[model samples]
Target: MPGAGTSINALPKISLHDHLDGGLRPQTIIELAEPIGFALPTTDAAALGTWFADQADSGSLVEYLKTFDVTTGVMQTREGLVRVAREFVEDLAADGVIYGEIRWAPEQHLTRGLTLDQTVEAVQEGLEAGIALVAQAGSRIRVGQLITAMRHADRGLEIAELAVRHRGNGVVGFDIAGAELGFPAHNHRDAFDFLAKAFMPVTVHAGEADGLESIRGALFDGRALRLGHGVRLAEDIEIGREDEENTYVTLGPVAQWVRDREIALELSPSSNLQTGAIAAWGDDLLDHPFDLLYQLGFRVTVNTDNRLMSNTSLTKELALLSDAFGYDEDDLEVFQLNAVQASFLPLDEREDLADAIVAGFATV
Candidate 1:
């Protein structure tokens, strides 16, 4: 058994749902915003960080998403994208993330006249630079871009092509994000179909602001290999009765399929509570269905969806889960293994990551 004295921050982890734009350092935002004459609510880095957290804790998904305007506003230039992407990797490494997939929409970064390809190349350059810096410092970390398309926009097919175009580069997967309620995954069917034909892996933002129907559309229409913030899938589970020896519940078809197929749920506990994704259950972290889903054998993986917005790191999120559910080192290892298995990497690469994780955990 793993020792209880181990530090959660020291555990090697994998991040599947972290956002490139959402992980910016407040100081980086300040510097990036200056040359462009983009005015901010506050110029001080610490104050700006607090501003993001305050603005994002709106308890409404739409409102919470508004905080991204400030971030994407600064990322419209190649310099901005590179710097942000570099810092994103460095921060993940500092948090002990062995592997991370950074997701961001190329469509959103085109407002400053940079073409989609240029933006991807720029970000890739930054990611490589960050990786080199980590190696120079005698530490190691790996990252990939999950090229994303805005669900509310009509550029899905274009973005999907762009992702496939850069697959040999740093891009690893495709995703659709933004406004999940009205904009179902099927809205991007052409793009999804293109990706499916190209054999590109996908993960969709479903069961966050939406429900089972949205999750079903993601699985059917988007062909998502994983679900982003799929916490709402818990709604499909109905508890009948509980005794000292057992607690029995029934699973709806959607939940049953997800569980049986082991489709990974990228559960960001802090982000879920801030966006009210788990409001139907309760307002607190303890109220989150993460424990419920994990106990029921769902392939649940921990993530820090937006580290800046949630004012959290992967370590902090895992610590919060431990505090809420009494999970020890062994349980935390399960989440890391789950994330590694669900990652977009090839089977051999996934096995390599799993081995690294297991070796790291064994020491602790």
Candidate 2:
């Protein structure tokens, strides 16, 4: 039904795994950097955009990590945070994202003397502003923040507290990101325990740069309600060809539990290829295990991990998936429903979101 262009633009979307700093507009980066005396690889918007996407395309996690240094470098003050956050939501709203969860680590934004509380408040203000701007245009959209802690950093507890402190104030959930290989979710046990006691929802970045053991830590230790970039969970699956028209899949205990429990996997098509998470399968989107996981009944929700770095939007992501996997409106709707079910929003809110998505898709 979504035939591309305005059709896809009209379909409502729910983004569960998007990074805040990673979605900054290039012009915003240059404008914000000028006041802070921060220099970038390029000042021209087109060239700068290419630079971010190229760095991410290096297929090296270390190189990808370097790209963020420029983004985080600019988001150190109240003004920069608010401006970036405002534009981020506005862009998502314009792209037909009815509901979104923007994730970023406040600890990383403390370089230029902003208290964690101030940074959160500033971002909240920006999100609210963006919401108002959309409303003024006769369009309705909502966004919630997922307060993230860098796995390699030592500020998990503090960030978790920050998320809880702003629970009903635009903040939706908590997450642990960055350096997923060596720094297991167990490293943030104290923070996870604190969030568990506080009864907050969490999502952990696992199965992206690591395997099943990392996913186990995300579940048992971090208590992640959703698995961030859990593409590698496919490693636990064994496939064998049956007759001419059939095939069979056998899931290991962990993968079986995940599928049985309906754990949502935030599968970012472009970003996964860029970061080499799906290298075992292949490098192209066509080679991704997304279709396999979908056919296996896994809770597979699509996302643009980093909008700027990937130079993508939810519409483009869906179009690319459709092109790569020959999917239709039904498949896209499944992704939206999975994301809605996996969102940290309350029961009534999530139901409302799902209903809206269904109705919006009906138009196409």
* TM-score of predicted structure 1: 0.98
Q: What does candidate 2's lDDT look like per residue over 1-364, in tens digits?
A: 3455447777899998889989999999999999889999999999999999988997766677779999999999998999899998899998899999999999999888889999999999999998999899999998999999999989899899999999979898999999899999999999999999999999999999889999999999999889999999999999989998998889999899889999899999999999999989998999899999999999999999999999999999999998888888888999999999999999999999999989988876
Model 1 lDDT, full chain set: 0.94
**Superposed Cα deviation of residue 285, candidate 2 (Å):** 0.6
* Candidate 1 collision pairs: none
**Per-model lDDT:** 0.94, 0.92
The C-alpha TM-scores of every prediction are: 0.98, 0.98
For residues 168-229, what per-residue lDDT tens digits would candidate 1 score against the true structure?
99899999999999999889999999999999999999999999999999999998889999
Residue 138, model 1, lDDT: 85
